[model samples]
Target: MHQEKFSKSTRTNKQVALHTDVVVVGGGLAGVCAAIASARSGAKVVLVQDRPVLGGNASSEVRLWALGATSHMGNNNRWSREGGLIDEIMLENLRANKEGNPLIFDAILLDKVVAETNITMLLNTAAYSVTKESANRIESVNAFCSQNSTYYSIFAPIFTDCSGDGIVAFNAGAAFRIGSEDKYEFNELLAPEKANSDLLGHSLFFYSKDAGTPVEYKAPAFAYSQDEIDAIPRSKNIGAKDSGCKFWWLEFGGILDTVHDTEEIKWELWKIVYGIWDYIKNSGKYEDVENLTLEWVGTVPGKRESRRFEGEYMITQHDIVEQKRFDDAISYGGWAIDLHPAEGVYSEKPACSQYHSKGVYQIPYRCFLSRDIENLYLGGRIISATHMAFGSTRVMITCAHGGQAIGEAAAMCAKLNVKPKALLAPKLMSELQNRLNGLGHGLAGIPLTKSDVLLKAEIQASSTLALAEFSQQDDWLSLAQSAAQLLPFTAGLAPTFTVQLSAQEATTLTCQLRVSIKPENYTPDLICKTIELDLHAGEQTVSLDFSEVELITQYGFVIFLANDKVQVRTSAQRVTGTMSVFNKVHKAVSNNGKQIAPPNSGVEEFEFWTPERRPMGQNIAMQITPALQSFAVSNLTNGHLRPWLGSNAWVADLSDKAPTLTLSWPEKQTLAGLRLYFDTDSDHALETVLMVHPEKRIPFCVSRYSIKLEDGTVLMTEGDNYQTLNTIYFKQTISTDKLIIELSHPAENVPASVFDIEVF
Candidate 1:
């Protein structure tokens, strides 16, 4: 109906200018977390994402699962899930989309971003240029959206680059490295002997489904032929059942430039994907594939490695392996140094070489600040880490965890009217850590900030869990592989444990009491005592006495060596801060019982004692001579969230009916908000995609809860809660001298547990 007049040779699209406290580039999980954290911290945030939807690698387009410190629960880091905003996203995803439908995940992320009033999300907007106020500071970023034909000029004092390719940082003259570092540069044994351009590659995935009837497939001209497909060293791994990320090894373009060569990489990956489908359909190798049809295939490849910007301090291999402590520590990581072959799918070498640390390690705040650009925060995989350290920190969840820290720092900077590096001051750094910890971000060895208001109140629970026994159930676990029961110990002589066991034949069981060298860690590196028990053919009770050995307060592992002839009883009772781990193999993450590294690889060799996922992984049935009094009412005010040096949670006795925690003060106090931390079985890896979880809600999470006054007036009632952090803000401030929190057990067999309670 309307016609536009003719324009000059060059014409510009619609131009828009925006001003905000913080601007975050990229829409990956890391950037999403960064924007959310900043917005929640009272900063006006503008989140610029180049894609149509958020969750870069984790989006439906790429379809890679989001994982972090839990490492699929394939390592020794127990209760190691990254906390705060990332935890909320994963738990929410689990509750709404535990089946891991990529499309559903996309909706969840979009919902979370849009719900934040302080956040202005600009999707499909790519920040292509950077405008600097000075050589070291970025004044604004210039972005464009081709779909809308719009140009956006976003001005902010603080800019965070969560982009996987370091787009903004690159344009802003931020120092970055794109290749591996020399071994001697950082004295990193895991580094290459000489610096090289080799890096992890890009990968594409396809999904197939049964049509209930025969479906035919025809190969396009670009698809690889049988002779070409046969040339791949790992072509034998292909099967009819494999789909999506299960074929993560279907990678390419590592040797080529990952950033500039992305399109070329996508084409090669497509050729490989279509070629594989063609082989399955026509090569007559797979039988059941006759009814299978290609359901979905990735349009864009997921990039693993690209540009790594320079920060004030670069984490190295030794920092990870030795579990180095940083004064400015803000976050933690536990995934192994997983490196893929540069040759990708065509290489004869193993698909990946992974070396795990003994336990979780700390990441310092200096690693998030740009070395050259002031007011710039580096986030995601681009954070300052050497090639070796990046191997572990490059995972999506780990990046997102660090992204929360970056966002918080940016908010703090805006509030203080200073540059990002100014937060490195001891007092400011402590404040930053406290803020992150208050939000439930797990920092190794960092205690929660003491609340003076909460301290003045007297806390009492209906009944505290006593160190007694996990009642034996009908289920029995076979001892075909080594198994261990993780238990909390006091700072004295180890207690005696009596376990019920049945033997297929008379056998001798070797029991060892072990603890980690570091009390804060769960790895059983130190063997305190060993005992041998003789078992009969029939079921009998056996005692493992380690009373002679004195130990510090920590989690002790009562390990039973593998004896195929014996089986141990399991308990239906699920307790907080307790789990049974097995020395087994998880082929997905390449964990094969133990990690045996090559000599001089600078990697430590340790056995992987990981917990099994639920529906299984029941605690071993055992009775103690002296009840361990680790879980107490005082633990509620201990200023620690999760299971750290000890069980930092107050767990109610299993027999207590209508469990409750009461906080009483001498005088009436005004309360506007209350924050509660619940046990979400942090040991369980909540993978964002692919794997199916047993329960939509964590078995140990509080399903229903109510907050009431001493007069019995209900303040807040949560009927179905599945998150780790529950913040309740009253519609109006209430004044009360006493408050009661009534809780229901998440599961019949699982006791009610809470880490900490804060009132504001």
Candidate 2:
């Protein structure tokens, strides 16, 4: 008899100990974004993902759609595209993965993370253990890879828990909650009446391919029969045309813990899925799926709910539904409060309940940092929020935004040698916002007051540009009703209104500048002044000089006479908080690819209104300085990106002549390089495949340009450009007090526009 004994020893060379400024757990979109944000901010980030691929649920394994503020433009929130790392990801996906192919998307995310110089990506590494310096701070995370048989000990100044399950935080004893919270606890209307451990459950989606011939499907003995799934509402929504996330409701395990009983839930979902396919193929019920066969099914379920790490601020349903503005808000969400029934697909009810907001809402900095844990920052689905609030925030793009915000904060904290809580300070928070905006992450309500050269410089432009334009359907309505557009203005600022008017024939138009006595109600109260204009049949910019009128409140109402002799400019492109009011024209008007018609008259004013074609967000077409700042060339120097919603490069008047922008400074500053941010139709989130997409490109981007500096230096002469941010580095230090930029017509032959320009 021989006794065999196996000796265990560390792969002396395989044992790896790596130190970084930020260590991010989980390689989903959130973790990847967090790592990228931190790395871009000059931190060495070590990204650890348990899966072989990135994107988590959005990967090929789960094949979930990466949705965010766009939310398929389902309801009130329109033209809202996520920015920051997520926007970058969407842009890359649209460029490379137009067909919504998961494999290609996986490669895009992987390539993005790898492209960052300071990011070290560790794939197939699962964090199972944590080392703590104190009860409230994590020292390091220990992870193991079964594939490579390697043990990794990663150390960092800050740790981001983007793991959907919050595994690292759980192991590190970070404060957390599981399942739904009672309504009474958070004063949330959507919460369950009583606190319970029931979760939103897991979903297993399947993709099918169509063969030339019929494909037969057989059900396993354990699969459900037709009668077994009678309670499900599949009959109403299911169809052969559906693929990818179409079968997302084929879920179960709400009664069981999502994490504790994952395998059991997965098996049940599999049986249900196969059973459904069998029924469709053999039952002779769904003729459309006759040639379809199951090509792939997600074994690891795409989870909807799980452990949530507690943070200093717990986002509630009220904050989301009411569109609450938080001073510390770092990111925004507008997917709607989508809550699935606890019984999941088997509930015989709608898969989910959705309540949309009027606009995007904020997610504060406190939602990312752990309430008690000093170094831990929560991200993705694990961010501190009541289950009711998570319904909207759980979407991948919003999660990615949160990840980016936390990553930037973590990097700043590491640089400053401070804790995650330190960023909550007002000064640091403002700095964080500036950094985010500087990186072109569009936070809707946050303004780029700092780092905006136009704010301090004496700015002038080639022309007072109109970001959007509207056509006149009919000039005369034959009604006495009035019309006005609600504009959000600062109380102290003297706002100017540039009304673009069009007429069928030469006619006169009268408009009264009215300020709402009740700021919230938009009722035309005291008439500040009345302006009469004589206009031709073509488009013209009529200046309603409200610069003399100091707005008493944030909103100043502009009332128009219902003569209908001339039509005012209106577009579907909606400004965030501003709206257009038509007393009688209740018919919905389309603007910016969205419907802008609000319902009939309300007792109070401003309740039902549409957005003008002018602009929204920081920029408006009305040509108000410090108010509608979009008309200035300095908008090119401001840090905002994603040109739609009036956040864009200043567009010159449409003419045969090219427009020139000159940058003049007081001192002769030596500049090394020039960064040009051009408009690339950031509004549409251009997809790689435009089979069903509306716009291919924004058409306003500057595709061709010429630049000449002082002292006979021709820099970037006649350069053809197609990117969002184009950098032209000068070979030598060009010492000058002024530089000139000539933007020629784009390839599309539209007006030349530039979003931003920077010299360093």
Candidate 3:
């Protein structure tokens, strides 16, 4: 295959053997994303990876579910990953593939990478070495393929090392740190007393399933006893099936060398897994269920902690716990500081600590690129950061975000043909921001528009926006108290990076959004330098301008308001309303006239009736009712309203003999027509069916009845269908003032749903 392919290329005789815009090494989540983003932006990209599949640690090898910080489905913040390329991929997988869950995930990643026009992925490819002649700019890379048993050469203008081990940067001559450093290095409160060999460790997670039959296992000698296995504690149970997998299982990292002792850890875990199962079935402590045994075991050990690269910025634990904000914040991680034991399971270090912040924290773009490597962009676990900080930033959701960040960075490098390091300045970063937003990657053009952002007069609760710092001190009473933060920020060492001015001339008030990517969430400090604005006993308009400021190190907007001491107000509009994000009405699909009774002979057909009111957003109701109903559904997602009685959209009640219009939507353009259902009930209930319309308003034709006999006599309508009240032959256009609905017509014979009517 190589010789045949080479002959074709040699005939063409291109002077440059291997040349491209960007070379992305490591076909993991971050690598694929970077390659796709760069290629989409008109850059030629070469994707190289040693692994067979693309999802990196979160792949079929380990079978762990994909998660992001802001993409959680339920109201619970436990599973949110800010919806992005990853979320879109998961949805696509759910729609198309129905193989086992792991295979489904693998297919999703493959489809995204292969379908892209600009990415050329080389699988089963390994990077033997990276030769960087400039120490700053990446010149080219050398890779070996096991499939062909041959070595090849590849050259690209820009390079990215998303290998999760920081291998690309390490080879690029970039400085990085691994494990805990001296506490003085970052002044982090969670740092160990001194630097050590400890890392967060890794796990090989596989679903525990028994295919319909229980298997008897011969317990291994090294397997942990039932007591010991149970002692591990099902501390973190996630996913729909409750897949028992501890992400921060750092025990192996401490008990054994994670990098060198991978095989040993696997050997030991295999023994422990079977022994635990044997004891569960034979121990007689619990009732045995059918097919209750380990279903699948992970072949690849999911690596949690690896190497770190040096970037333009370093996020710290203090930044998270303190709720710091930065101007260059390209992303935000909503998960708690889910740090496992720094010193393995049996060590002296605490197992974990809560990342209880005042609110969501932003991830600055500074952490995306290596400071030393001018053109090389890094992401995911390989992003530059100290070990203690990596603990909070290394989760899947944040890593996915890091993927997007570096992806955008690769795109910018190729588009401008400039070193990524040169783009770190705020001026160039704005352009990057525009690019990311365009691809639907960064915080640009959020579905919530500027007009969608509701500006208000006053907040009822005062301290909702104060810059209150929570350390071991302030209780996390804020989110429960008001769901808003009112932090009174302390100034960082600076020459006032921001200046805030109120509109009022008489009163003087000012605020400065300072620099400091730590303490206060590494969020740029918005310090109120002065409080002299127009609050003349009433409402007034005031604005603070930071448009002139050059740098915003972290992410998130600085909302500034002025008051005499303070005024009550509620600013910032939530994407969905206050009740709940699940206020949607599902339109039940109709069966082919099978479940519904036929309309009378005189009537053309029956259609379902419903209000055009949309469901109100975000709410939970145990019972559906008129006054307590929700109607905030989107324009396309069930904008029509259903009866508050129950989930039945427009069911025909078969209790009466007559089909009379208790309620029907008026074919009018007024709100009255749409809101009539608010006060409707069984009085407005249909004994039969109402005719559905194509417009927002539904027209329910009165149910008329007629039936023919074998003797040629018929009870017919005097309406448009016949000339006389009684007729033998059927004609056209039947009409009726009252509907002959099938009431008391046995519960089994009634048609519950209505769509459109058809006349034969």
Top candidate on TM-score is: 1
Q: Candidate 3, which segments miss by more than 4 Å at Cα?
A: 1-17, 71-80, 94-100, 219-251, 342-351, 442-575, 579-760
Cα lDDT tens digits, model 1, 1-760, are 9998897777879999999999999999999999999999999999999999999999999999899889889988999999999999999999999999989999999999999999999998999999999999899999999899999999999999998999999999999998899999999887889999998999999998999999999989999997789788979888878889988899898899999999999999999999999998889887888899999989989999999999999999999999999999998899999999988999999999889998899999999999999989999999999999999999999899999999999998988899998998999999999999999997857888868889999999999988689899999999999999998887988888999999997889999999998888887888998898888898999888898999887898999999999999999988999889999998777789988988898998878888888889999999987888889888887778888878888999888879999999999989997999999988889888889999899888888999999889999999999999999999899998999999998778889999999899
Q: lDDT tens digits, residues 491-514, model 3?
A: 222121121122222443333333
- Whichever of 1 and 3 has more lDDT, that candidate is 1
- In candidate 2, what are the lDDT values of residues 1-760, reduced to their tens digit? 9884675863343679999999999988899889999998899999999999998988887888777765553333434667767876776575555567788888988899989989988889999999999998899999988788889999998999998999889999988888888878877766767998877888888877898687778788988886665546654566666665767777678888888889999998888887777776777667677788888877788998889888899998888866788999999897767767777876876776565555678899999888888999999999999888888899888898888999999999999999989888999999998778666677765755443333333445566454333222223222134567555454565555665666777877787776645343333456788888787887777777666776654455676776656656544333323445554432211112223322331101122223222222112224444444344465565555543334345667555385878777776777787766665543343322112343323345576776777565677774544456566888787777777887776642256777666666
lDDT of 3 at 91: 37
lDDT of the candidates, in the order given? 0.91, 0.70, 0.47
Error of 1 at 422 (Å): 0.9
**Clashing pairs for predicted structure model 1, backbone only:** none
Q: Predicted candidate 3: what Cα RMSD to the true structure?
A: 22.0
As a TM-score, model 1 comes out at 0.99
Q: TM-scores, in order shown?
A: 0.99, 0.79, 0.57
RMSD per candidate (Å) reads 1.1, 7.3, 22.0
- Could you tell me how far off, in angstroms, the CA of residue 567 lies in candidate 1 after the best superposition? 0.6
Q: Could you tell which candidate, 1 or 2, scores higher by TM-score?
A: 1
Off by over 4 Å in 2: 1-14, 449-459, 466-630, 634-649, 680-696, 717-732, 744-750
Cα-lDDT of candidate 3: 0.47
